[model samples]
Target: MRIDFSNWKPLTIREVNNIFSRISIYWGVAGGCALDMHLGRKTREHSDTDIVIFREDQQMVYQLLKNEWTLYKAKDGKLSLWLEGEYLDAVSDIWISRDNQSPWAFQIMLMDCEQGNWIYRREKTIKVSKEELFSTEENNVPYLKPAIQLLYKGGSSQIREKDFSDFQSVLPSLSLKEKEWLKEALKRQFPLGHSWMKSLED
Candidate 1:
């Protein structure tokens, strides 16, 4: 069976929650899809879910998702991949970082179910409950605080237009400290409010 979003059994936002109610794994709803999940918007069909598998307990992460999944990378007779799906575009390297500064790029197993047209662009962040925010799994997938999420997205100029718009959309909910942090983070990145130059200073 191809790991296709088209054929993917539509998992309700709530269902995703219930499934992980007690899984001892470090995971999060990441990628552009995550943005949509929170906003209750029509996210583009995803070939696979972007999960942040911590550097440790990787084997366990694989065992959990190995069902009908494909591996994207392999090392020393071991598989280091990203994605529980078998799609190539659906599969990507995992990056986990803190302080919005350091990101650890690692390979992961990606099972691509089908070919896709649009590469997902970022945007949309809904503040869900705390239970939804934390991962109970054994993996070390860390949750990106609203501040860090905004900071990281804003720092990257190559970020898709949708992602930048998403950042702006979530701007109102950002805490004062988050805004300040974003300002500093982006300023260091793009010479301080280069795009919304005034917004950063304000």
Candidate 2:
């Protein structure tokens, strides 16, 4: 089916928190939205919001939203209806909307994990404990740490203008430890070098 990319009306952070309140598994706001949450203000307008969950918990999330929302598996530049109990092992992006005709609401991104450590899907060697991976905002909403979110943005093949904007907006807020962790992660992920590495240095 043809999906309208421009028809995105993402949910607010508080709305997402209420929707996922019943979920007992590991999940948190991710992507640019998470970075904004860490900054305690909306740095810029976002086209969509992202919620992240471990791959292992995909089914649980699927079951939760399946009845009330339309779920589509987005892979290989295609969108298809996500069937019940369908294991999207190779897929990481899932687009959700209130209904087929409604504007897209938010995206659910699946992350790889082992034991209790979060693993970077692009690079297995990069992992961090759950505590280090997420931080709860004063509003009681959980979000991916700014440094980790920046790392994800840096991994994009073509860094967009917004990605750099997010990096710059959150840089001053990051602790020394966070900067060091992100720098080391970028080093391992891009052994040759990354433009952001120099900015992350102490």
Candidate 3:
């Protein structure tokens, strides 16, 4: 089925927080919005908001939203209804809406973790303590750390112009430690090299 990309009406960070407050599992804002959260300001327009939850916590999240929300699994360029209690082992992206006809609310991104460490799904060897995986800012808004978010953007097979823009916009704000972490992660994930390493090095 063809999806109407325009139908996305992402909720604000505050809204997301309010909705997720009912659940006890770990969840945090991700993607461009996450970078903006780290910067304490919006950098550009974002078509959708993404929230990440560890893959193992899917059932709890599913149970929380199953009653009031319409969830569709997005895989191989198609969408299908996500049956109740269905474990999405290989699926990573889930689109949520109020109902079949309602504008899409937000996207859920599933991440993998083991033994209290957040494992990079694309590269199992790259890991960080779950405690360091996310940050709760002054506003109490939890979000994926900028360094980790940039790692995801940089590792994309087809990096977009916005990804570059995001990197440039957030680079100046990254701490020495954050830059070092991202640089090392890029080196491991892309042994050949990465365009962002030079900037990180300097």
Candidate 4:
């Protein structure tokens, strides 16, 4: 679901914590904000904040925010109001806002998991344990690992300009293990002619 972007302002880190910290769910910052978190500083202006939450804990999020915010299911460029206690596996994104009059605060990208293993939605065969899915900063903020985030960014057939910039920003700090993992993942997903594969190799 989209909102009034005319006066849009992305939530700050403090705002993110205040809204979600108390909620009992396995979630972490994702997308551009997540890259900033891993770097321990904001590197650029964000159009919106992306947060990841497992499908299983979606109700927890719904329970916590239903009273104060309106929930809308966003999928395939369409928007629909999320019914209370209605869990649709097909819905991957949930947009939140105080009301129609309010600008959207944040978006929850629902993910699939099985027995503590993170199921790569794009490719179910690819899996990673929750431990590997995220890492915490000194301040206790959880964010998707930079390598994994970059994998997601580059996994697509066409890489966005922003993804290229983010990859460059985080490349210097990648551990040997991270680089290897991303390289292998790219191999599996792209198989051939993937633009990022060359960069990952060198």
Candidate 5:
């Protein structure tokens, strides 16, 4: 089957985890890439890992990873780092929970808590600890879930036709249970766009 995710597997699974393990980078594999992992899709050729990191972790991330990951600034102070062919993008808002940002226009990745914690020592896939991983409470906006990482790259800050298009593609993969929770999540996370969900669903 032809895998149609936006970002392909640019690096080996081990390599992706290794780069992120340093400085406890909080990221997730979102977009078609994440869907592929969930569906057990075969590894295909890719150039980027399609990742998201917290704004607060920037300095710590640079100090530990600059030698390997070169920083490149995108429009609006948005940044990214390239390492061994994979790219990691810095999101505007990451650490705060109540203050919701945007939904990932890409794949969603969890810290692989099932595999292992994000600790470099374990040497296994970095596990996103449950306590650390955030999830949508009852509303629909994106939040971290165990074994999954949510990237907030949405809203007026990143308002682009591409963002909605990406969300539409991933909609089918979400379950009814998720759909039910998401609406509420959206309300709680994005009060401003309480109508945004309706527009997306339409």
Candidate 6:
């Protein structure tokens, strides 16, 4: 079910922490919110907050979230049950809420990783050391790097206006290495040509 609620209020960063901080799971901000967190400012309002968790740590997340929220497999624009202790073999996204009536609190991106290396889901060949996948703000909130977040947004042909805005804001601050990494990743995913690759070179 491509479900959306009438009172769909997103969780604030503080609210996000109030709930999940004690879970003891390897988690951090992802998506547009992450881009803003890395930039140390809120560029725009977010529809929902995204958090990344290792696929291996699914149980821990389930245990941490079970009592309060219902988890649903959000794939191909549809939502379904993400049962406890069940292997999330095909789905990589899960949406959490108190129930269908309430606003969605957050979404979880289940990522693949090995040892301490963070694997790029779109291109398995590309891997980044865990040390480089995320960085912390002055307030200690961890977020996905800008370049990586842009890489994810780049995959869709229907890239939203907000995503383009995020690219513009983040591109200038990206280091030479970060630019190069994003260029290479984009090249692999959009082999023919991608607008962002040219900008990255400049």
The per-prediction CA RMSD against the true structure, in angstroms, equals: 12.6, 1.0, 1.1, 1.7, 13.0, 1.7
TM-score winner between candidates 1 and 3: 3
For model 6, how does the per-residue alpha-carbon lDDT over 117-176 read when each residue is reduced to its tens digit?
888787788788877787877877777888888988986767888888989988888899
lDDT (Cα, tens digit) per residue for candidate 4, span 88-153: 799998777778667778888998999899988776788899877988888788888898889889
- The TM-scores of all predictions, comma-separated, are 0.51, 0.97, 0.97, 0.93, 0.44, 0.92
lDDT of 1 by residue, 1-202 (tens): 1122122233343444454434675455555545554444653554444454333435565555356334444333433444553333323353221112222222232221112211112212212333433322223333335444555455565777766676666666666876776666556556534574466556
Q: Evaluate model 3: give its TM-score.
A: 0.97
User: What's model 1's overall lDDT?
Assistant: 0.44
lDDT of 2 by residue, 1-202 (tens): 6458778999988889998988898789999889988888989988898999999999999889988999999988988889898998999999999988899999999998898899998789999997678889998888998888999999889999999999999999989988998899889989999999878874
Model 4 regions lying over 4 Å from their true place: 1-7
Query: Which lDDT value does model 4 have at 10?
Result: 61
Please report how far candidate 2 places residue 99 from its true position, in Å: 1.2
Q: Which residue pairs come into collision in candidate 6?
A: 1-79
Those runs of model 6 whose alpha carbons end farther than 4 Å from true positions after fitting are 5-7
Q: State the RMSD for candidate 2.
A: 1.0
Q: Where does model 3 exceed 4 Å of error?
A: none
Q: Which ten residues in a row are the worst by lDDT in model 6?
A: 1-10
